[model samples]
Target: MATNAEIAGRFEEFADLLEADDVEYKPRAYRRAAEHVRGHPRPIADYVDDGDREAIEDIDGVGEAIADKIVEYVETGEIEELEELRAELPIDIADITRIEGVGPKTAGKLYRELGIETLDDLEEAAEAGEVQEVKGFGPKTEQNILENLEFAREVGQRQLLGEARPLADDVLAFLESVEAVERCEVAGSIRRWQETIGDVDVLVATEDGEAVIDAFRGWDSVDDEIESGPEKASVRVGEIRVDLRVVVPEEFGSALQYFTGSKDHNVSLRNYAIDRGMKLNEYGAFDVSNVEDEVAGQRVGERVAGETEAGMYEALGLEWIPPELRTDRGEIEAAANGELPDLLTREDVRGDLHSHTEWSDGNNTIEEMVDGAAAMGYDYYAVADHAEGPGIVGGMGLSDTEILEQVEQIREVDAASDIAVFAGIEANVDAEGEIDLSDEVIDALDVIVASTHSALDQDAETATDRLVRAIENPAIDVLGHPSGRLLNERSGLDFDATALGRAAAEHDTALEVNSNPRRLDLWGSAVQAAVEAGAPIAINTDAHQPSTLEYMRWGVHTARRGWAEADDVINTWELEKIREFLH
Candidate 1:
């Protein structure tokens, strides 16, 4: 059966194709339906598989037409209408539009005028000066595409952590049920909680390697078998490639440590070990201090540690480093000195201060969203709906009057709610680094998460200055999705993190690590820089619906990757403490 995410992805593609085809109004409707489909708590495919069309349509924003298409998809494993759209364009619309300035409409025009379908075609056209010759495109546009095409192609090869992690969890759950598998854990960049990963790597410990491999091959989500052996196998799951390796129980820890690495980190750690007469590898850590002819083999010396990851670190006289901090950025030294940060965990967060409701583009009402937050055991929640500005379109943004009206409603809901409902607005930052809201509206909001939604192509210096200026504004409490980057899509802004952070710290404005999978902005390195500069951080879901509020998990891991401690994230503070910070 198709997963909710998979079903929603098809509709997203449907919307993209329709927009590329220049179909009016239908694109937004499809996208809205797709959002609700993705955020719906229950499995939409289950209802379709059960032949209950009414149940499928019961989901918000899902009408009868979409219900029929979903049923077709669940039953036949394909939707005829969507397939027709693909056949009509016959272009890699999604990949092509990944270019910085290229949207679906531009993609459709290019396909029609230049017969461009793939990145190769686009690059070829740009290189031959043919793109500039097209009526609407100019030399600058052609150059921009040429400059950004490589980045786009590279992005296509990697999957977002949010998308791949769930699949990894599924694989783990399946492996745990196999009688022959003794132990299993994810490794590689996925284990490190990297923002993006190339593939999923699973390491299992089992005496019966063949049985483990056979059981893995039998998993239902396995889309295709790429290759298999007695102790290892690689398979294609959906679009992702999952590699599994089976080892003896004794080698499981060493294997996991060796695989769950940033190459630089491993190289540094190896040199550090060698300096102490020790050698480390996948098999085990060995003390070669008294051994002669040390180059004989991996087991030339007495084994010091082999069975547990923490023991491996203990043998090195260091603390066990979390996987997220395996970035080789002084983490080894920090661990050796017992100075590694106590990274913030999910439970440390007291509330989410960035969220949306029906006042803007969100699907839920303020009351419904607050109830959802209360159910999640949050002490507070903020309704930061979009304010009228650039990038937010189609009457989706609230005017001054609408914002004040929403604030009143939020307060009314807050009066009866278990959690403190803070009134907020996701105000747009113009090119000049100024929010468009009036002082009255700004004052009324408890939190103002100002973000750059337009003119994202500003140069590094200008972008940094713009962000700093926004930070200097007293009304702006956080700079949300600081770079405006959409993973695998727009490259968004370029800025100096240290400068942005220092300015944020000076002005008491927090930096946000947006939890929306599409935009995990202020990514690990940038977050590190900001935190180092003493800027407060906010890991918010930027959730548009109740189900998406659960996105806080991704945000927490991302913050950990940045080395953020509980005190660094304002959302983790008590209600009174956060209120003081807001003031």
Candidate 2:
């Protein structure tokens, strides 16, 4: 059976092909299906083998045709349609399309017209005086392609948040050091803590926009300058392009509103502004009733965006929306109705349900991990070092006997520490759908988080069955990172979240939203699916080191993306409630 990655990859290729063909809505459909399949907790082959396409069709935007394709790929070990598309076009689609202005269609056209099938081919064509010879091509366009092709290949795709965040922080720090940059913030999906990031967008509020732009271009890390303007500057830091927008202090808030966006969310906000007799753009909010440029008799050609984020919201007659809640979810409606869920706050977390110490591969010691949790004002902490099973070849996992011995040590620490230290094991759910720890050891721990650590090759049915079996176990308190996904590296287990969620609800198992930036598993969509099925969630750090404990910010932000509230999460509960719920 083809892995989810393999199937998802082919779909992306098809989507890219359709995009090259300038196919519209269908690309979105295919892309959405690819995301759904890629994130689905079950193997695609199981549904195919069982002749149940309903599971695939049940995905949010997947329909019969896409579901059929998924099944066909599973049954035949290849997608014939994709093969046909490949044979027809047979261009090195991804590589050639990486050039800045080149889309799939442009790539296809260039390939068909100039026989430019590779980056090298395109380069050769550009160098050999072939590209400028094409119908709509020019010298500038060729130069731009030559300039961007290497970058496109180097960046490969959008950087995951894990990879881009440090660079953003460094830039933020550097910008703040600039005298002209009075205030600065990352304004984009990065601020929203989305799992994936395209370009790093930093918005600066400055008294002197030109000075700020000049300072940005000179940023130490900037390797190449893409474009420099009075208001905005784009630079390449390594392979990632960082866009810096400098706005006067007065227009800062408005610029932030314009830049910190999921475009769909911005579109909704802009319409909201329009309905209120105000026009919102990067410059500032304006009243355009009497002007052709959409701003007349109001703050046209003036700056007033940075007075306050609240002021911007006040103009729109809505509450200041938190960046995490900026997705075009229920926030707009909730803000309108004054019914926004009191979101889960960092302070609401009573304990870390999934953590590691020296007993496994974690960097911190047990005493230090407990002390850190206590220092953070947590009422309790569970040391969930890995348990031996399929994935543990040597030192990474604790044996059943070792885990039981650690339970005694946990009791010793619990007796001494001011905070409660719960003994738990991050037990591996083997390919055969069973957790490695024996019932006796499971009964001894205060919490048990069963997770997939091996046999990731299993078909979705097998993976889902494995996880569901563990979820059905009476001792398993939480299911860690439900999808086993590692950002930019691996996608998690292929379990049917709806089905597993139902099972979790029946068995009272919490699904973990791992906060580690690299993982961010049980993503917002999965959390929503689980919540819809009445399954409780646990926002955990899955912290390997003390510093990683702060990863909860990303997790909490991610959970809010799923519309998770205090009531939906176990960590958001008080310590007594947490213990009672687990008990």
Candidate 3:
């Protein structure tokens, strides 16, 4: 049976192809239906299998035409119209449009004009100066396509943190069930909470390495065994690659520290150890000061520290740094000076400032979302659903009158609820940096999250200026998803974070770290720059459903990776303090 993701992917491709074929309204309808399908709480396939076409059509933005296609796909595993369209185009539309400045229209144009059907063909055309010769495309455009080709090739290899972390948890649970395994942890970029991860790395401490390896290979989730040895193994679990390594209980701490590395951090620590006549590796930290043989291997000299990560760091006269802080971005120096930040944790988050309800492009009601927040023990919650604007489709954004009506409903819900509920709007920031809603409507809300939903391909300077203008708006409390990037799919904007951060700080505006797995926007580096510029951060889930509220963990870790302390995030403040800031 097809999952919602698979079905939504088909609809999205259908939309892209239709738009490329120059079809107008139908493409928007398909795209909107695709978005709604992707976010629907229940399995769309289940509805189809039950022979309920009305249930499928009842989904927001899905019409009868789309419903028929859904039934055809679920029953036959194919859609005749989509296949016909694919046969007609006969090009890799997705691959071609993934280039930075290229869209479906441009891809279609290039294919029609130059018979370009693949990235290789496009690259060939660009290299031969044929692209510049095409009407409506200049030499600079050709150069840009060439420049971004490498990035396009590297785009979809990594999995999002939200997708990878759960798989890691499952593997950990399996390993923990083994009696030989004394300790187990997931390391590498996942441990650092990078938005995208290449693979899941698991480290284990056990008396019997062979037993652990055998158990891992025999696990039910293993799809294919890539390689196996007495102490290590690599296997494919579902769509992700899982790498496992086992060490003795004595070296577990050192092994964990070594494997939970950003390569640069390991290099820096190794050099620091060399300077102090010590050796550090996966085995343990050792004192090589009195050793006669300089070329001696891993366990060659006196073992100075091997029991704990803190011991390893202490051997080098430094404090233990958090894994998220181990990116070699001055973390070693900070540790040496006892200045490592008291980073923000999941518990520090008091409320989410950007979230949605069924009022606009969400899966639940205002009361359901409020209950979800209260269940999470939040002191306050903000319902900041989409407001009517450009780039918002299928009537998903609320109108001015609708905004006022929703605010009244929010008040009624709050009156009966234990947790404080603040009504807000995720106002669209237009290309010129103006909010879409009227001033009267903006003033009526308790929280205002201004975000850019369109015009993402502006030049860096223009993008920076646009965000600066939005930050300068007194009514805007937060700058949502500063770059507007969607991990592995679109590079949303190019802007100067320093400029935007400085402007936001001056205007008392908070920059949001949007915690939706796909859009961990205002990513760690940007967060670091913004925080350094004296701008406060707000780690929001931007969640469309109640279950997604748990994504707050990803946001909090992303903030920690940015060196943000609890005091640096506005949402970590008490309700009165947050209210005061809003005023």
Candidate 1 residue lDDT tens string, 1-583: 5655567888889988899899988987787777657544345665765678887888756898988888888788899999989999988987998776689999999999999999999999999999999888999899889977976886665798899999999999999999988899999999998887878999999999999999899899998676789879988787787999999999888888999986657777888998998989988899999888636887768898978888788889989999998876679999999999999999999999999988888999999899889888999999999999998989999999999999899889999987899999999999989989998897888999999899987765677789899999988999999889898677677677878888988989999999988888877877888889999999999999999999998999988988999999999999999999994
Model 1 residue 114 lDDT score: 93
Per-model TM against the reference = 0.75, 0.82, 0.74
Better of 2 and 3 by TM-score: 2
Which pairs of residues clash in candidate 3, taking residues 3 or more apart in a chain or in different chains?
A: none
In Å, residue 155's CA in model 2 sits off its true spot by: 4.3
Instruction: Give RMSD to native, each candidate.
Output: 18.5, 4.6, 18.2
Output the lDDT of residue 549, model 3. 91
Clashes of each: 0, 16, 0
Model 1 worst lDDT window (10 residues) = 35-44
lDDT of 3 by residue, 1-583 (tens): 6655567888988988888888887877787778667545455776776888888888867888899888889888999999999987867888888775688888888888999999999999999999999899999889879976876776645789999999999999999999889999999999988888978999999999999999999999998776789889988786677999999989988998899997668878999998998999999999998888646677988898877878899999999999988866678999999999989888988999999999998899999998998888899999999998877889999999999999999999999999899989999999999987787787789999999999987755677789999999999999999878787788677666677778889999999999999998877767887888999899999989999998898899988988999999999999999999983
